[model samples]
Target: MTDQLDDLIATVQEQERRLVLTRFTHDDAWALGSLVVGLARERGLPVTVDVTRGAQQLFHAALEGTAAHNDVWIARKVATVRELGTSSFLAGLQARARGEVFEDAPWIDATRMAGHGGAFPITVEGAGVVGTLTVSGLPQADDHALAVEALELFRAG
Candidate 1:
């Protein structure tokens, strides 16, 4: 389990390093959010997607079959990314790798910060992580994968 966590950590770190944008804008948010929605629809995934820069939301969508609770999850995941400046999944993995519970940390509020997968930092070249692209409604790992896949597609174009 430790080895697997370590491997995942490494992979996530690599993703953070490589999946960087030259810049992020409202148009980029729309494109990325649409890509995620398209992919989710293709897979029949019931999910909510959100993109935000600081306190400003750029784009948001909730697919069919998703519930209000999914938005709650999105908020939590986004908060996790905002606070940690890393992928929420990576934060969870790093905590587990250290045999620590992330939410148990004094600075963490379990209700508003989820260490689960699905929220990814929107990193810009030379600007660092300026926002988050988040998804919810699927299993945590799948949600994370969907977000990553969309980011990869957006980066490729």
Candidate 2:
């Protein structure tokens, strides 16, 4: 699966380079959330999207078919990004590939840290990662792909 991971890492790095924001203000967050939600609707995806910076939740939405637990999963995925500086899916895969369980990671609390998928770091070109944009409710791979796709679409415009 490292081969697949290698590709995902490259895609993520490309996004980091392509999606830099000079400043992610409240308006930007709202626009981003709306855009992501629009995309989800178009694809008939039942998921939750969240964008947060530090302690501030900039944007949040739960699509039609999502349950409240999707929000819980998003929180866990966000925690994974906070601790690893990488997408949660990649972090989880790397941990398992190493014969380690993410729950046992020294720096994470299993109850709060979920190294699944659907969280991507929001990067500011000169400032580094400032926040995360996340989606949850699909299969882990699909969740990650959807987040990446959203970022790509946002970047293209």
Top lDDT: which candidate number? 1
Worst 10 residues of 2 by lDDT: 8-17
Window of ten residues with lowest summed lDDT in model 1? 98-107
TM-score winner among the candidates?
Answer: 1
List runs of model 2 lying over 4 Å from the truth: 5-14
RMSD of 1: 0.8
For candidate 1, lDDT tens digit of each residue in 44-91?
Answer: 999999999877999999999999999998998899999889999998
Error of 2 at 43 (Å): 1.3
* lDDT value, residue 120 of candidate 1: 97
